[model samples]
Target: MINQNKKTYFKERISSKKYGVLMKKIIIVAIFCFFIISKFTPIHGQQEKIPVLMYHHLENNLNSNVVISPENFEDQIRTLKEEGYNSISSQQLYDFLNYNIKLPENPVLITFYDGYLSNYELAYPILKKYGMHAEIFVITSRILEKNEKNSYLNEIPKMNWNQLRAMQDFITIQSHTWDSHYKLVSNNGVKNAALYGPGYINNNFEEQLQYEERVKNDLILSRKLIKEKLGYEPIAISYPFGIKSEDTIELSKVAGFKMGYVIENKKIIKGDNLFSLSRITVNGNETGDELIKRLKS
Candidate 1:
């Protein structure tokens, strides 16, 4: 009888120990899973940074140095598609900056400047073919004043209100500047500035202030016109001729633009000022391989 009792007690103790061991293993696995999930879960309110690409004319007739041929453009788009790059809108960029939107793994923002009519005729079809969207920065004054008699691309017409409205459904319409790109001369002695927009030749502090004020007024009018035409205020602006100044950034912010774009070879990343985002220029001179190399490097 004594042996039987001892055996029963030992068996119960062994069972209890085994159960405790199993429970401990289960707890460890649960804790590890929790850790992994926490690591992968999206953060609630962190801004994401990504690169924005700038492009101009898409034609073979323009200066080969500054225009991207249609075939090369198609090739570039195909490469991006094959590589799984997701092209998003400017609003998406703003959301990523303001809210913690989880952008795709390889995200890019494609933009076209000058409101070229070719953008509507040629680039639009190609973009739609690739299931991509782009942002177009229009010179509001030009759009408002463009007449039917003016020749665009020697064939296609400049985007009228109907076409512009249709584009707004797929692309985000942003402001470039009002009367800012006819002839621009920066105070830094850049020669092409005069050809891009208004020249800033004055060196006096008061004169500089006046020049800045004039620019601000023009930009303000641009914002109003964009709002009137598009029914929403634009939050982004590209400096005319990619010319930037400290005063220009401040004025842009005051004019209600949250971000600004510049033409540079660098890709945008975190810790960059929102008002001075860098862009990669796409011109006709670059082949698909060269463009890829430039972007990758």
Candidate 2:
């Protein structure tokens, strides 16, 4: 028992230490994003709870954990409609957060990360039939150019820019990162500097300059290409994998993203931290009623 207790304590100590460092690394990005947003969209002084539901794929191959069946997805949307949950955009949230604008009685924002092919084909039609719109954070590099080999592991390939354009009538397409959607792994550790988790990207992890340079390039590259291709500036960035920290949060500001979204398995609300916003990731099998129940609980 004593030995087990010691092991648990040491494990927690190491975990806490790593978490602390990660939080510290986030400080610069957090403050930077805060400064930019404060100028126009100040944080709301009042509390307003809003749920931002996240979906990845509208297909089912049972290969990835993020897949949600088209039927299930439609059911969820229907449930939201039946429940009187009005969908809102990140811009609306931002305005509400900053300007204290009046929002609908029950505002829920539906967001899809990793622009999947099914989004344009399956999800778009369903959302349209329901007269609902959503926010799609796209991966610029994955947006298939003509004749490009779709070797990415999306199961169903990502939607092309043309298809995305057609969906723009009801969908608010945004940036998920140009080339930062993938992961970087090393024997020492792994870093998702696209929107980093904790560790530095440098070999020694001491070269802060190199880290910021890579971060800047990655962030700016996505926004630049997105603006050039999509013909409109992307207002928000949904961090790839919903992974972001203070560093990435501030980088979104430098990279030209006004709002940032991260996954924290909680409902977002007005007066919520803008840069470090949380979201509830919908599982593949959980039906709409189940999601509603989870929200209530």
Candidate 3:
């Protein structure tokens, strides 16, 4: 009887040990699953960083730092589509930044600095094919009144108003400025952006008030021209050469621009300065894979 009691005690002890081991394994698995859920799930209050890509021109054979070839542009656009990046409009961005509205997953903005004819002839079709949205900040003074064919293969042409209107389905037209895209040489021969300078030009010093008035006027005119032609007010301005003075934001606000963009080569996040938003300047030399890596970086 004593021997039987000993055997039964030993069996119960062994079973308890086995049960403890199973419980430990279950607890470890639960902890691992919790860690994975926390890692992959979106937090309630997390803000998203949006990448804004800036392109200047597109051409068939021309290759330059600012000019991307048509093939490369299409490749880039196609890759973006494959990567699940959704293109958002400026208004959507503004609403998201200001009103705390939720944006679509993997939101990005594709922008062009100048309204080049190639944007219409080459880039527009690819963008449309991929069902992406983009914006072009046109120098209002450079837009031709009517569409015209390019006669010279070597000529770098600007998009006309008709072309601009035609691409409105896929492209948003914004402002580069009416005529403030030029640079002024100061008395010391140091050049300054016309919109940002109150410095000496042609040996004459422009007063601060004079500089403010000049910039304000140009901004107003650019806004006016866009509204008149496009039937909507422009809410953003791309600083010429991405240069601006200390008062640039205030001046833009007074002239009715809701936001400003710069070529600072950074992604924009919520709570970023609205007036000096950042953009990634895309060059012809970057491959589609490189661009995807850049966006991830």
Candidate 4:
């Protein structure tokens, strides 16, 4: 009886040790798989974000807060390429925001406001050289039939319709506004963006109906003109001076825009407001490296 009991104890102990070893191996394998899967696969329900860059004039000698030099612009684009960023189109961005479509690795957006001729003369070529695409928002009233042949020293020239058509392959044109880029002072002499409303016009405060009428008309006209000239309606509009109100957002939808961009100085993430999306302004003074650092942040 004593011999039999000893055998039983020894067998139970060995079995316990073997089970422990198996559990440890299983746990280690699970941890390794978790690491590999997290690194290699896109996890569902994780927040995905992309940077949208807003650029203005590209000038040779004029490097202001908004006017980037051609050399620096090229550097920025080159750095973006090296960093594995792909410039997604405006429509792609919309689909990603709405449909949860998988975006390319490290997707970014390049956009220009005010539709300066330098966009065609300078930025367009650089973008084409890099095989990148961009969007330009034009003020409809400022677009002329032909280039003014003017100098950036006096007044930075606006892009002509011909120039706009020429760059259509690389540059997508959208609406800035018709004629609402200026400020409208209220009866109390407090000035604000024209889209802000309650403006002092015709020696009287603009009624709510009147303000709505003016803004809707301007946006509709902008959309209509782009469709007429470019053969397609624009789906997006960047507010003048990045100014917009709740009313403006609803008005934008009424104006037939699918998306509206604002200057919030941040990247846009999934589940954000489709209207009032954020854009990071690329500072002209910053080097390409600095710009990359900012983007990483």
**Using Cα atoms with residue i matched to residue i, what is each candidate's TM-score against the true structure?**
0.75, 0.76, 0.81, 0.83
Candidate whose TM-score is highest: 4
Q: What is the C-alpha lDDT profile of model 1 across 145-169, one tens digit per residue? A: 4446443345334465556777765
CA lDDT, every model vs. true structure: 0.74, 0.78, 0.87, 0.87
Q: Model 4's lDDT to the true fold?
A: 0.87
Between candidates 1 and 3, the one scoring higher on lDDT is 3
Q: Where does model 2 exceed 4 Å of error?
A: 1-46, 60-65, 151-155, 185-194, 197-206
Off by over 4 Å in 1: 1-49, 61-65, 144-147, 151-158, 182-206
Which residue ranges in model 3 land beyond 4 Å of their true spot? 1-46, 148-155, 187-189, 200-202
Backbone clashes in candidate 4 total: 0
lDDT of 2: 0.78
- Regarding TM-score, does 2 or 4 come out ahead? 4
Q: Compose the digit string of candidate 4's lDDT tens values, residues 1-297.
A: 999999999999999999999999999999999998786455785666789999999988667679999998999998898888899888999998898667898899999988788898899999999888899999888888675664334766888888889888888998998878889997678888887676988778888999999999999999999998889999998988898899989888999999999889998987788888998989888877898899987
Alpha-carbon error at 69 in model 1, in Å? 1.8
What count of clashes does model 3 give?
0
